[model samples]
Target: MFKFRKKKNKNKDSQALGGLDFLSIFMRTLKLLSDFIYVVIILVMMLGAGLGLGYLASQIDSVKVPSKETLVKQVSSVTLVSQMTYADGSLISDVDTDLLRTPVESSAISQNIKNAIISTEDENFESHDGVVPKAVFRALLTSVGGVGETSGGSTLTQQLLKQQILGDDPTFKRKAKEIIYALALERYMSKDEILTAYLNVSPFGRNNKGQNIAGVEEAAQGIFGVSAKDLTIPQAAFIAGLPQSPIVYSPYNSDGSLKDADDLSYGVSRQKDVLYNMYRSGYISKEEYENYKAYDITQDFLSSGVAETTSHDYLYYSVFDEAKDLMYDYLIKRDGVSDQDLKNDETKQAYQDLAEEALKTGGYTVKTTINSTVYNAMQTAAATYGSLLDDSTGEVQMGNVLMDNSTGAILGFVGGRDYNENQNNHAFNSYRSPGSSIKPILAYSVAIDQGLMGSASILSNYPTTFSSGEKIMHDTSEGTAMITLQEALNSSWNIPAYWTYQKLLSEGVDVESYMSKMGYLIDNYNIESLPLGGGIDVSVFQQTNAYQTLANGGVYNEGYMVDSIVDSDGTVIYQHEANPVRVYSAATASIMEELLRGVIKSGTTTSFKSVLTGLNSTLGNADWVGKTGTSNNYVDSWLVVSTPNVTLGSWAGHDDSSAMSTSSGTNNNKYIANLVNMIYQAAPEVIGTSDKFTLDSSVIKSDVLVSTGLKPATVSINGSNVSVSGTTTTSYWAKNGAGNTVYKFAIGGSDSDYQDAWQKILSGK
Candidate 1:
């Protein structure tokens, strides 16, 4: 009975403990659920805060950097040399530059502005927000739909965005970048800013620097030399229409009238449409628009300023090369650009492609140092002379030059007869045997400098042979008499020249150094006959410049035609400074002047007597110096003439050194002399009268006697009535019909009264 009671109590206790355990389990489950709900609420709030911070960060980053279009709008500004003027101060020409003008605010508006902005472009620009969704959709649909042609969905804004924010290179990545930048720009900036950036960055044309120019204002001023404010509605429209493809619509793209005319017609039509659009948009009154549309736009637009039409004037071209190389160096050094950046295969390819595109591009204004008037005259003169040549005989080629004696400024030049036929400029490119023209510089000038021979010093005009087997002979008229050094120069006696060379060699002067000083050398010559003026080659350019040094009073100033180079922005990039060095004594130059004067008066160039006589009378008895030369077998002919103000040179020859049929004449009747005569006829006014030297009366008579170019004592002639006193004798009397002495002139004697004698001989007084 006791055991049964104990078991019942134990069961009751177990049931109570079980009930407490169930309650504890239920409470724990409820607590866990409450904790989970709290966690969920905290996570929701945290996510909301993180998303807000991320949005703010994106907006902040967007505001920090400019859009790609804005960045592209800022191009490298080009520098150039401003033009120098003549003594009269007329502008030689405008300078070359990339920037057209200073940027202006966008609020200002003109009919030209309206026309340039809205005509054939997005006509609905006022209604769109940096994009035209409809156009984009249409383009995408056509392209994706595999239509026959791919359409451009870019609106005017998008195009501007591409040009101003992105670069000229077209790529998918860049396009995407442009879109992003354009969208961001639209969000943060006003419409006016976007338009301004677009106008400033869009390429209207190229400048003389070969850099792309952007903006109508800059293009108008740069290409037309007129300000945007001064441009008419049609002009504005013309600028506006160019950006579609500037080179393709350029007026100066070709020489053919038909092609140029076609381009002009297309440009004009597009310009008219721009005007009409401006009128319809109320940007301009209908009457104003109509007046502009009727205006003549084909008025030789390039003539608005200086234009570089062709590649002639090799000196100018050389300066251009130097300037370009300098600029290239400046760019590399200043910009810290590596060689790879400049000459990399990819970069070269890019430049090549750009060059191809540039061929069609126009509206570039290049201002060079070349004087257009002088250059034109020189070209015309060369052409006239070339036309006179019988190409069948192959004596047609020619070279010409005009330079400022004081400054060594090359005013005019012609490298060849015609640049079209022979692109090589013989004046600078072809080196030929200079013949006796080099005698004056290398021999006479050196002699004067060494004090071994003065202008009045006497030298024997007799036959002599060097130890090296080089024979020198004088002309027969002079005989073996004595003549002044000045007389020998005038007559170009081979013996006198040889003696002078020997004297120079005997002195401490090294032949190589002396030749280099005078800027002449024999590339290969008969060393034994070095004094004979053989085997030396010189370009017409070098000869002209060397002569110019004489004209400039022995100061060796490099002859250059370019005055300055200017950028489109009117900034000076290069202004040539005189680089002068004394090459010879002033006395030597004066002596050379005196001798050259004798040449024109009475020397080997007697054929030019009529022209020289006329020229002298016109210049108030002013004296000029000149020289004539003919190569062996008449392969080359050269003539150089100089006054105080100008020096001119001419060369005539076949490019391949082949002898022309007309060149076979025995008398050395050089074609160069004929070409020079032609030039004088065309521009007689260019010969100035201020040269101070007077012709030496004694030298003139002495040269006349030296026609056979020997000393007077060594010549022989016959006459019964005339008395001969020297080692040789010549007849002095010309008898009349009755055998009376009508004219009596001494042949084998020096004349102290040369002036009176020449007057009697020339005037028959």
Candidate 2:
């Protein structure tokens, strides 16, 4: 309703004014036209290039494609076993020279896996005639944009043709030839035949130690330690996801352990993507997809046949398994032997066969971290102790791993009593419950690292209930009310450990993740098993490496057996190089070591002192530390011993988790002690039985009241103040113990009252 006079100006406002700027509009129009012309030019260029490539492909003489019968026949020929050697370049005798392939029928592979592949790689695999036009256009656009070759576009039939008849030349001519051959093959073969061949021939991945893993059968064995028919949804998803990029998604790295965190996360993400694709394609229900989506792929991972006790010497199995995987990866991935080349008539050898030929015929050398003298000692110890415990029942089996504390090098390994009697190598691949031995590494050390307590901090050692209303009590405490961290660990008391874990949990710490930081795989830290070291599984290798972390002042160095590998032509193919990762402070590690020494001095492991004395006088006086763990029903007994230079983790149990005879006069801990003593005696230079831990400067040694965990305090009693002082109670703390406390008490004036009061105060009654 309000009217205003318009002010006149030479400058125009595009929004305020009715008409737009003529020059600006003209420039924008020109820009849009130019952009259109630029796109047109790009299209013209791409079309010309594509037309030229097509013309040249038509002009080229047609190469002879293999017949269907010949293709199928070639798939099963001469899959060879890789060769293995000792560190000294000597060939391991009686090695299984036959090829390693346990082929599974095509129908046996899980439908989830098939659907996963179809969804991820080629969604139109069932309907397309070897290739999809839309996918081809997308790929062509991506390539023309200089984004490199995209993965999708080729149907399963086309992939089969590319793998079988047409080689991987990565040229325009090869691409054209593949298309032609794929079309022809599709006409010759049924859709089911193409899919089956593709599934069988696809390279899923290689395992750790360099073994060539091909086909669904080998892939299933390599990744899950199961046959193809037994593959679960998660396992199948992992395998089906690998053909896109074997090295990138493989659960095991080149060294035969789980991949690093980034790669592992990426691999898991890819698997989930495949699962989601299956879900979108209606191959799985929403509930099934959701359930499987929560599964962690690493939970079921086993590199090749590690879980299988193959018909080979168990002594060399650990390193041999790793070396084989490395050798195969090197031959194909590094040395440039394609799967097609492996299947070619000219090569006459699969990648594994080639690796074997290189070792056997080409004179390649395999090197490892095994210390020969220590290895022999461990072997002898196992045989002697095993025979003593055999009792003709053949139930007792022992596994041990001796590792260098400083270097993380595996010095010696024992799989079982005898390879001929039992094929399962409990040391390398098998997982067992660790029992109370895990206190220092899992619960107590983690608590120490988090600044919750020091060696002398007192924890209520009585039966206590957790937030979940679950109670934990120690068998060794016998109604004791309080104990220092050192005493609890030395005595293997469960209540103190569980209380410490609860403290950590209350502070929002994920104990399972904390244990993983020490290099063990765990899903969740259950309250019931955490303090007692039950409900968790670990291999001897993993357990020993964990103890090595304690001995190395909390620095975790991954344990590796192989040192270096040389090809037949004297080229260094692979090298073992590990950098120590510090997981806890030096003070924490030193405190843990000192506490473990208590186990040797007066706790569960004290019985081995005489055994140490009998082995060598130096060992008796050595500053050694150890812990003993006995599982439920005495099913598993463990003794992990460590000196400055060496650490040995030994497990004695029945293969089927049956009880060992406590009354049979065979003590597993004594046997382990004997083994440790022999290993030290055999390799005194490497082990140094008298070597002692060098405590960090931050690890301040202080005298404290054993019960109260404070600087030895004076108690007012019987009209006189008695000073409670002793050299026996020592504690290691970070810097000066500033925030620590000591319990104060008062007593009545009587001889009996004084005695009773002193007893209550001293004994934490």
Candidate 3:
């Protein structure tokens, strides 16, 4: 053991030399590996630089970058407020924006606001040329990164381009174009120009009154009652944070009501985020950040104390909504978008957003069909009378729409008594049950047009129900057993309409077609009581237009609010062109007109007939025709009426579908009457047409027996068969002069005995 140990010790120098040799080889291999890694890193950097440059260069050709002059002009151009004019070219209001927008120069804006926005929205605004390459790459991978998770890859230049020019399409092509445009724009405009333009165009959100504010100037003025130049750090911090999520972080709700102190946490929290960014970016020190972080942004949000909409200003929103739809269709066609592409919801929403953006920024002159004189007069009248319909809760409201019978252009309306009190455009928004008012358009006109029934064709008006034992109701407690169609209509008897609907169904006549042509869609056509105004809802606009067809010589012209739209340069972009439909034949219209004329004179709407007579007293002998409706349980009251020149539809109901306090037949008739008088007083030209209704040549009036509603057979002693004067009543017919036998149709608890009962009536045994 001693000898072996000594031998091992003797080889110690050789062991140390061997270890040194191995260490030198290992060091040499490590150096070689380090050099290779260095070369690889350099190559990778070169490759990245080449790819980035090539990517940017490839976009240059695809993107038609505007010239430097155009770019400068676009960024510096003013955003003009669009105008909405009445038919006579007088200003009704300024559209596009609801509140006043104060155009500000860059010098007037507070430096604090600029710094706050810069720190939060785009930290690289000053340092970057156009974009951050690394940020762009990440956005391409995950999302169209905005101001990138913390520092969104999108610079101020890119954001401005995205909002003002390149829309939010969420497409690779759109992102590529956005990058290309941003780079081009940076070369053309100065940093100050880009920042100022961004500040001016950016939407800071709704103010304390819920009015949408676009520029910093309006934001400051409407929110804090201070000028943009006077915004403090806290106010600027709050405003700077709003562009990311305007409505969500706004202090006011959509109804122009201020949010509760507790509900305003989002705005407070977002402001803190802005302050933290400001602190991190060196715009604010740690002490300032901590102080502003504790600042209550909601406390400084002074109430704007301004009305969101004036008495008649609410009409603009409806008009704008309609215009958006029109622009959507127009843009889709102009861009040659295929129908298949529209099935994609994203693509459709992008177009919708584009249309909305154009309306807000296009500086359009929207010519509307409103008659200011009539509108003012009607509004004045409605103020006095509409209060009569308000319930104790002030929840019951009224709506009315007056339309030109010739063109279906909306002439005037009563959306609500006060726009500030309620922003819902009742005339366009509310869809209440139409009740018996639908009888004229749906049941009788279809029956008349189908040649199954005549204006005076007899209907058995006894108590009856459906073949399936469905309950039938009449305006009165009971129905007359044997009544002419004219008398049934005069009384709004539901039994006759029910029988007519059944007959139409048996004969395969489509009542929905006529209703659709008159601008009322029937989603509940299968409802048994649909003929009596059940299972369907209609707005004043729809009811008025439906009646307009009857007065417009059977021509159904779709109702229009906007007559035309002209761009800022006075170039006509859209002109109202009507596509008139022949909803009813001339004979059908004339016969139905004659039938409904008695409705105003002596039937359900007779109470308001005096107003029509008084207003038309000096104009001419033009007749008035109308239909009255009351939904089940008196939840809604409706009057759709027409004169020679115009049609008016009015409704009274609760927003929550609560029953009206008025009884079934007496519903708000006085209000309707007063509105008519006020309309005439405001503008007599509204009902100026003196032309008498002309009946069709095919129609003939004949006297029928009082007992059976049949033409008396060569009576021995009788006066002319002009009307049911004494022993006979007047009747209308196109074939054989209304000599058909009495059908006397009725239904029991079951439909088993209907045919037999009719057969027995025919037999007279």
Best by TM-score: 3
RMSD of each: 23.4, 19.3, 15.5
**Candidate 3 residues 8-124, lDDT tens each?**
221121111122244454453344336333322222343344454233223222345566676666665556777788889999777655544566889999999999999998888
Better of 1 and 2 by TM-score: 2
List model 1 lDDT by residue over 1-765, tens digit each: 000011222112111112224345445334423633332222223234455433322222222234334343332122223333432345544333333335555654344665458645767666655455456555545644677446456666677654432433332233334443444445455556656656655667543333345665666665555766677767777777777777665544333122356656877787787778777877789888878889888762644233344333444444444445444443344323355555566543443443322212212223444555566666665665455544455445666777778887776678876566667788777888776687777777766666554454445554445565545444234334445565666666666666667667667665565556546655642243354446577888788888888877777877765555444445555567887877876656765786777777774543444444543445425556777666665677777878888888767777888875543321222333444444455556555655565322322122123212222322222222322122221211111111111122321122433334334333433
Report, for every candidate in turn, its global Cα lDDT versus the true structure. Answer: 0.54, 0.66, 0.72
Q: Any runs in candidate 1 off by more than 4 Å, and if so which? A: 1-319, 322-367, 387-392, 458-484, 510-532, 614-621, 661-686, 694-765
* lDDT value, candidate 3, whole model: 0.72
Q: What is the TM-score of each candidate against the true structure?
A: 0.49, 0.58, 0.72
Candidate 2 residue lDDT tens string, 443-501: 78877777666677776655555556755545433335555666776777777766676
Model 3 alpha-carbon miss at residue 567, Å: 3.4
Where is model 2 poorest over a 10-residue stretch in terms of lDDT?
1-10
Off by over 4 Å in 3: 1-74, 96-134, 144-151, 171-177, 183-192, 204-317, 324-362, 386-396, 419-424, 468-471, 603-605, 611-616, 654-667, 697-765
Cα deviation of 55, candidate 2, in Å: 20
Go through the candidates in order and give the clash count of each.
Answer: 39, 12, 7
If both were scored by TM-score, which would come out higher, candidate 2 or candidate 3? Answer: 3
Let me know the TM-score candidate 3 reaches against the reference structure: 0.72
